[model samples]
Each structure stands twice: as structure tokens, then as C-alpha cells.
Target chain A: MHPHDPEVTAAITALDLFAGLPASALDEVTARARVRTLGRGARMFDQGEPVERAHVLLSGAIRIAQAGSDGGQVVLRFIGPGEIFGSVAIFTDHLYPADGIAMVGSTEASWARADWLDLIERYPRIALNLITIVGRRLAELQDRVREMATQRAERRIANTLLRLARQAGRATGAGTEIGFPLRRKDIADISGTTLFTVSRTLNDWRRQGLIADDRRALTLVSMAGIGRIALG
Target chain B: MHPHDPEVTAAITALDLFAGLPASALDEVTARARVRTLGRGARMFDQGEPVERAHVLLSGAIRIAQAGSDGGQVVLRFIGPGEIFGSVAIFTDHLYPADGIAMVGSTEASWARADWLDLIERYPRIALNLITIVGRRLAELQDRVREMATQRAERRIANTLLRLARQAGRATGAGTEIGFPLRRKDIADISGTTLFTVSRTLNDWRRQGLIADDRRALTLVSMAGIGRIALG
Candidate 1:
């Protein structure tokens, strides 16, 4: 399919970024965007690279993370379909602040920075939407900062699971399972803990019958149980 | 002074928020803004409050923070003259996500949400500048998240002091002093460390002639010393 295929435009129109935009404006957006597909474990962009495009995920799971000086990775967030990423760096000094890695096979629509900037100027509503998008992310990061300062490892991990479940949880026969394949290391990075602590915590939660895990896919067997821990 | 005073217009023109706007547009901006004076210890806004207005700091020091469910506050950032604050929360669900408090007597120019939105539409440059401002803050938060996930408290504290110094440092006889009066608790909150840890770390730095503290004021005696610690 071509970049300007109606299917792509339909997909773009369905995204929150294009919410309330008229069809012609959507066409403008669709015309300028380029589609990028990534295999599992492939990175969309690395931190500190000059940002060329702003992206919106079309499908699959991608995790945004930052690497420490010690070579450890800290997951900033996970993105699924219709979510925006890499745009935040465009308004900055033009460098991606985090790495966007595909957790699973994924496809995204990307617009060159100049085109995106012109699009935002021509359609101020899109600019407003982008502002709201960045604002909410800032709020999330603020919450993480507060939790890291005040909460212990267990509570942070519980809250992290709860948050991921809410953001991308899928219902199953067992319970609400996190939609994406999540590893213990991702939880460690998100919760500011260690792999060992996450393993130990998951083991404890498993024994208590609060969760069911098969490899990466985890289902919260007892939302109430996890909620109690998160509240604590 | 009246809200439409030329002094206010000049200050508004000088702000990074209104960068690249023409004189008439600046006048329009000045006309819509209301001057607010906050005494020391007063809060500009609290978390979860409806965002009534967006603000630009005209003078004095302010600290932005968020309170966790445990009733602990984590300092998110510090603001000085010509810097923007409390604006990030405007575009999100209309609720402030953090608290902005005056550390000293402060004067600010605020525009009601309707007015600010109108200004952003009328002058897209302001909107662009706002994007850059929020983007930079987001990048800072991302770095803090990574540091919280990977660094020890001592290194985090060093980075915190370095950040504060860069944001609002005053070159004095001693060194580059943090422009605001910061207590140990605030430092702890900013660094994601405890007051005890901050106290111990400050003492260690002071003994090593890295910093000088008098009451609530802190002066970084050696930027090189702190930079080395922060890098670790």
C-alpha cells in the first residue's frame, strides 16, 4: 500500500492526535507522513539522535526507555496503537531524549519535523492536541518522580503493574492481562527497582494467587489484591 | 501598576514565552494578563485544582512540587524571573498536576485559560515557544526518572544541586549560589533522597569544601567537584 492509501488515512484519522480534524486536514497529514515497520527487538530511535520525524504508532507494542551512564536501561513508557511518540524531542534541541524500541513487531506513521511543524501551524487544533498530549505525559512523569521519592519498591512495582494494566490491559478468561509482553526488567525499569526485586515480588504475588504469569504475559488474577498493595 | 502598564508589556515582551511576537501582539498579550503577587510561603496553585490561569514568573523564586499519597512533597523544579510555570497543566483535563509555591515574595503575570488559549491561537509563535518550554521540562523529567532508576542517592543529590545551580545560580563571593532559599527537605525531595541522606551528604560535601550552606541558602563552592560526583 502507498503512504497515501485510504487505509493509512483512515488509521491516522482514528488516532487521538487527529481527533476533531476535518477530512481535508487529515489528507494533508496523511500525505506528508512516511510509514515505518519494525521487527521485534528493533529500535525506532535511540536517545540523543537528531530527531527527523514525529511518530504515531500504527500497531504493536513499543517501549520508550533511557540508558544510564552505567549502561542500565530505564523504561519511560510503553506505546500501543494510536499513541504518539518522538514528537516531544522535535520541539526541543532536536534530540530524542529516550530510546524507542519495539517490544513486538510494530508499524508507525512518521512525519518529517519540518512538515510536522508546518502542519501544526496550519492546523492549530493539532498543536492544541499535541500540547495536551505532552502535558499528560509530563503529569505521568511527575507522578513517577513523586513515587520514586516517597514509595518503596513493592508499592512502586504494584502501582506500575496496575498502571500498565490500565493503559493496555486486555481481558482474558483468567483476568485483566497486560496487553503487551512485559518482562521483569521492564517492570524493574518502570518501578525504579531491580530485576531481583521484581522476580522476588512476582514470586510472592504468584504464591499469594494475585497474578498468573506465563513467560512475559501476566494476568492480574486479583485486581483487588494488587490495588490494595498499590494503595499501600 | 495597572495590568496594561508599559512596564508589564516590556516584561512580557522580554519573556521567552512571547519570543518572536510583534509589538502589537505583545500589547494584546499584556492587556489580557493580570498581575498576581504572592507572599513567601504562599502557593500559586495546588495539585488537582482546576487550572484557572497560566502564569509567567516576572520576579522572585518559586518551587514546583507534587505531593504523594503519603503526604510527602517531591520538588519537581524551581523557577526564576522570565521562566514559565504552571502552564504545563493547562492543556490537560483542565487540572493542575503539581503545586507551584513562592519561595520568596514573587510577582507573576497570569492569563485566564480562555485568554491564554486565544493568545496561543492568535500567535502560534507563543504556542511554539510553549512547546519548547514544556519539551525541555519533559526532557529534564526523563533524565530525573533515569537517575532515580539507576543512580545512588549521593549522586542524585549532586545532580540535583547542579541542576538547581544551573537553573538559578548567582555568582557570589563564595560561589554560584542557588538563587532560592532551599531547605534540606526540599533538597531531599528534589534528589529523591531522605532528609537524613541529604543532611549527611551535605555535611560530607561541606567537609570536602564542595559547598557552603548557611541556614536555607546553599552555595556550590566547586562546580567541578559536584560535576564529577554527578557523573558517577
Candidate 2:
């Protein structure tokens, strides 16, 4: 088996969903996964594309999004290392319901649906893992739904910042610096607000000494205060 | 095997994720499922309960919701017959993230975690189906996220009516009537808007001859126009 390949082994091992699988199952999974490198701004898949494989983020970032009829786009979620996307469409036998684009230079690992299905049949643990993964995603979406229904735009923005900080933040003297490379529009997309609103809110937060932004980096000044806003 | 018992079958079949399991597998499933009845406005599970069984809706409606710190509640989704809702916490190993309440008199089917895992082992098709079902829910959440980010309140209200009409609507000469028993607050909860906003939008639609609400039943007078508003 080519399971000795470092990249394949690394990718499978990194995925938290596959944590409990035996080494043998890991080898089997790696054998079926095909690794591909992507460049920034590359379209990984378009809306309505046939979903033949599930893509896992091994390195870098990918944005799952939808373009509306009004020429506007919405960013659904940003996938980072160890996360799997496209598994849903692969199982459903339908075209992808959304589009994915590379947010940075990235390496993605993918598995054919047939091969993955075969593995799921062979390993029930993987099935459980998948269920857990999907369940977590559903819970996250439910949270988002709640936020959209009840929370104000500024509070939603604060919650988004806090969530991102926890997921991809780096430590600095100022606070946890969210280091993900995101444009203001990308932030707007993630937070479910307009770019103008994002700009205005950020400016307001900066004036109030809650946050500071430098290029793609944002440093939180008061996580406690941000939490208060999110609770609103 | 008691397969003919609608309560048993309904709970077992509520999950599209568990479809295609053989009778023997289903019998095993039936052993673990508890049938229960709830009165209107009764809480099936609270927001912070320890989630042990995946609750399957048999008859009547359940609102999966999140309560705001300010004592407001946002209904995330309405659960109907042949649908599942409590699987999210099972997958995440977290406390119940939302409260589920019976919107009307209701019956439910529920299964323990051990039985759920056993079924996954015995029937691969069911596992795959669950994956697909969760995936579709994720896609729907993505759509909602988009609406919250870019769409205005008017458009959100329009899209919500279109969605509810599709979900619970019945045909009539006036138009497709959303027959589900709903309060203005429930509509507001589902549409992610304030009750005031929902009231104003409905009034506007009524005045413009686009919709008619007689008690709890909402009739669409102009679907095409509603679609235009939703698309914007």
C-alpha cells in the first residue's frame, strides 16, 4: 500500500473526524484519497457541479459560498485544515448546492464517492464519525439561525469575530489576533451583513477601543466586552 | 415485528438518514425507541438538557428554538411528521443547543445512542442516508445565512412565506394557503424578523392585494410578485 506516503498519512491523521479509526482504516482511507494543490482565487467547484468526491482541506483555506440572482454573493463558511466539505453532495447524488473557492494557496485531499462508500461499509466507525461531523455542523447552523433571528448586526459581528478568533486566532500582546486573510467583503459575507455595514461597524468598534485592524489581521482589545455584545 | 404500528414505524422512518434498513435491523431499532405523547406547549426537551436519544417527530409539530438572554425566543425550524431533530446534540456530544416545544398535541419516537450506533453498523445505507440528510440541512442553513447577510427584512419575509407555503401549504382557489397554525410571533421567529416587522409586512402585502390572512391561514394572492420580492 502507498500508505507510507507522508502527505496522505498527514492529511488523514489531521482530520479530527477520523481520530478513532484504526491505523489500517486510516491506510485504507488514504489510499482512496487523491491530493490536489490549488492556487488562490481558484474555483474548487461551482454551484450545481456534479459532486463525485468529498473534498477535505489539508492546508490553506477554502470558502463555501453562493452567488445570488442579484449579482451579490454570500459566504457560507470558511474551511480550514482538518475540515471536510462536499461530503454531503457526494452522498446525495446531486449537484453541489453551493460553490467553493480557494481563499489561499492550498492543498486539498479528495475521495471518490464510490471508494468512500466502500470504506464506510467496511468501517462503521467512520460512519459514526461522519454523523458526528454532520451533527456538529447542523448545531452550528442552528446557532447561526438563532443569531440571525434575534441578534442585532453589531452583536452578530462581534460573535463572528469571537468565533473566528477561537478557530484561527493567534496570540499577541494586544489580544487574540485573528490572522485569517479576509477582505472586508469576506467578513461581511461571513457575518451576514453588507460591506458598508461591516465598514461602519468596524469603524465604530475601533473608535470605542474594542478592536484594531491591520491589513488582514484583527486584534481584539476586550474579549469580555465583545462577549457582552454577542449576548445582546 | 410491529412494523405496522405507525408509532414504531414512524419513529424508525422519520429519519431519511435511516432509510433502506431491513426489517431485522428495524426491529433492533424498535427495541430502543420510546414512544411518547406531549400536550400543546409542553417542552419535549429543554435547551440545556443532556441529549441521549434522537427525537423523531411522529404526529403534530415541534418548534426547535433558542431562547435569547433577553427572554425572547427564536424558532429555528418546525419539525413535522417523518422528520428528525435531536440528532445534532448526539453528534456533537454537547448539551442540547436548543429547546424543542410541541406547537400542538404531538407524538414522538426516540432512540438511544447505543441503538443508533448499532443500526449504523448493521445498515450502511442508513448511515449514508443520514449523511445526505444532514448535508441537505447544511445547504438549507447556508441559504438562510445568505438571506440574513444580504437580503432585507421585506425580502426575508417574502422568502419565509414562500418556504412555509412549500412546507405546510395546501391548495385552494384563493391561492396556496399555509395551513399550519401559526402566531405572528411564530412567523417572526421563522422569518428572523421582529413581530412588528412581520405585522407591517403582512399588512403591506394585504393592502397591495398580494396576500390575505384569515385567522391562522395565510393565502398567497400573487405568488409571482412574492417571488420577485424574495429574489430581491
Candidate 3:
């Protein structure tokens, strides 16, 4: 769709990079964007592909990951609505480092590389905002590295749950439910533990009444307990 | 020395963030910068300090690290000549996430926060360059996390040595010498192993003639062998 579409303008303006741009500039950006809607498990971009555009998720979620030579996949992060991904290519080498896959139904607004670079040049604040965003991501990634290096599997999983809860938790009758659709393997991959370990830990938590778990959702029955475990 | 000093101007212009600026702009940046020489083992800034300036290392090396509450220290990475450090604080919450310590006799050129922000406003390329730097850093940190999660101690240390060799390796008669003052504890910290493990591994490597080690220098005697271990 054309960037001039009202829907596109609203979405683009809401983005931190495009926020505060003049209406005319926003119109220009909107005019230069292409929007795509994808089904669950659809691949948005492949690792090592020349990154030709920057994407802003309009709705739903996207998983960014890298596949190892041994067929093991590491989930780098999950991008939710209003967050931009694949834009790192604009500032550095123009190649995607990981595969961007759609999680659930997703809508993405994309801008061509040249157009996005032009916008950044015309609006320096966009570049500044991007630096801030990238810096925060780096800091978070470093924290994950530290956790993986020093923390135990239990503490790692506990911290990961708390982090996910903070990002996508919803209050429910049972407890604070994690709003994301996460599988056992996702938790295992994220926490650097085996699937069996995650399963056994969750079973233990269920028995202890520390958490309520289902196939697709998890409820933190006792955040204090989880915090204690995370601290340990 | 004044900002117009040929030495300062030359150094400033060499930085990636200032690479393409006009001489007049370089002079302006130089005028706003303060150059300091730090002795070996000097502390540049502590983690959690309010970031007040951006620094560009002109000579020697700097080590950036974080200290744990339990007195464990993690060596994040080392910065060498012409690389910018301590600038991540400029874009985020203005707080340094790690301590910057001088590894050897080091000369750094620094700009106050306000002046650096003004410089970035006047030159958008600086912000773009920073994005590239931070993006690469995030990618490297992610690799560290993945390694810590999936790799064993031997493979992790091997990979760490390879990385450091790539970053700061100096060709010598014995082999490709890593040009940094790395202790056993430093390698252990970087590889998330213990000093005992690192020392044992080094002793094993020395016996196998796979690496040449000393108190202040480490030479890779066989990159092929190290690569094999790292691949495992």
C-alpha cells in the first residue's frame, strides 16, 4: 500500500524513529513504505540476505533467530507491535544477520534501504533515536550473556520468565499470565537448558503451586518465589 | 594543546564517527575535546556512573568490564587505538553500564556530553557511525551468549582466544601473539570458566605445542588445532 494511506501514516508516525517528523515528511515516508501481512510461521527475511529494507511491526509478533550449522536454532529476540527490526542493516553492512520469522499473524511496514537512509539523513533526530534504541538492545543482550555465563539453569529460566512476564504479562484470575504463546522448547532455548530440564522444572513448579502451566500459556502463581529463585 | 593542534585534528578525523567531516568541523570538534593520558591500570570510569562525556582512544588499550555483587568481575571486551569507548552512555540513559579501565599507557580524547550532543546534531554521520558500532557490539555480545549457552569450557576458551587474536593479534616470530596483557583469570572471566580450568587448559595446550603462553602474552602456535576445538 502507498505510504500516504491514513493507516500507514498513523503507524509510521507512532514509530520512535519517525515520531515528531513534520506531517509532510511523514507523508513522504508513508509514500515510500510497503506493508505486508503474514501468517504464523512465515519467514520475513532470511539470514545472510542483503537487507534492502527496514521493517516496523504493525501488529502481531516476529521472531529473529539464527540457525547453526548443526541445525540448532537460537532465538535472538521477539519483536512486538510498534517495534522496528532489520533496521540495523541501514547503519552497518547491508546484510541481515538472522532470519526474521512471523509469530502468529503479523503485519509489517517496510521501507526500502535508500528511502530509509534518505529519511535518516534528512532528519538527524531519527539517527539519534536509533542510536539510543540500538544501545539499549546491546545492553540487554550483554545482560543475557552475563546470565548465561554465570547463572544456573533454574535462575536463568526464572529470570527469563520474569522478563517475558514483564514484557507481555496480563492479569488473570489465576495469576499474572504470560501473554505470549511459548512452547517448552522456546523456554529451553532461551534459558540455555534442555527441554527435559524445562519440562521437569515446570512439573515441579506445578506440584509446588509456584506456577500454573498449560500448553500455550503460563501463570506465575508466586512472583516472590520466582524472584527468590532468580536471585539464587 | 588547542583543538586546532594538528595532532588533535588528525586524531579526531581518523575516528569512524568523524571520518568524513570537513577540516573546519574537525577543528571545532577538537576545540571541544580534552585529551588525557592515562597510566597503565588507571580507571577511566566506573560502571553505573553518570556518563558525562564521550571518549575516543588514541593510543594503547582499554578494558571495559562489569563487577558483580559477589566480587566477580566480567571482562566484556578490550578497546584499542582509534576505537571509541565510553560513548554508549551518550545515547541511552546517560549511565555507563561497565567500567572503563586503562590496560596500558593510554591516550584518550574526550568530549563533554553537551558538546558531543551538539556535534552530533551538527553532523548526522556521527550518529550513524555510532549505530554501526553499537550494532556490531550487540552482534558480538549475542555470539558470546550463544557460546556460553551451548559450548563447553574448552571450546569456549578456544573461541575466546581466536576472537582476541583476531581483534588484537600481533605477528611475532613465535606465532601470532595476542597483544594484550591477559592473565589466566582474565581468560577465565571472558570464557566464563574458572582460573583453575583456564590454567589447566593452558598447561595442556602448552604440552601439546598448540599454544605458547606467558604472563603477559599468548601466542597461537596452531590456529588449526584451536579451530578444531572451537568447532567442537
Pairs of residues clashing in candidate 1: none
TM-score of each: 0.95, 0.90, 0.92
Compared with the true structure, what per-residue lDDT tens digits does model 2 show for residues A1-232?
Answer: 1344796688677687677888888877887788888899998889888888878888788888887766567877778788888677776647887788888898788888788778878887787788888887777777777777677788888888988787777889998887567788888888887789999999998898898887867888889878888887
TM-score of chain B of 2: 0.87
Best by DockQ: 1
The pairs that clash in candidate 3 are: A3-A30, A3-A31
Across residues B65-178, which tens digit of lDDT does each residue of candidate 3 receive? 886443446788888788889898788878888899998888899999999999999988788888888888777776777777777899889989999998888888888899
Chain A: TM-score in each candidate? 0.94, 0.91, 0.89
For residues B1-232, what per-residue lDDT tens digits would candidate 1 score against the true structure? 5677777777888998888899889888998889988899899998889989999999888889877766857888888999988887778878877788999999999999999989898888888888888888888888899888888899989988988888889899999999888889889878888899999999999999999999968999999999999988
Tell me the lDDT of candidate 3: 0.83
For DockQ, candidate 1 versus 2, the one ahead is: 1
Better of 2 and 3 by lDDT: 3
- Candidate 3 structure quality by residue, lDDT tens digits, A163-214: 8787678889988898767888888887888999899888898899989988
User: DockQ for each candidate?
Assistant: 0.74, 0.64, 0.63
Which ranking of candidates, highest TM-score first? 1, 3, 2
- Sorted on DockQ, best first, the list reads 1, 2, 3
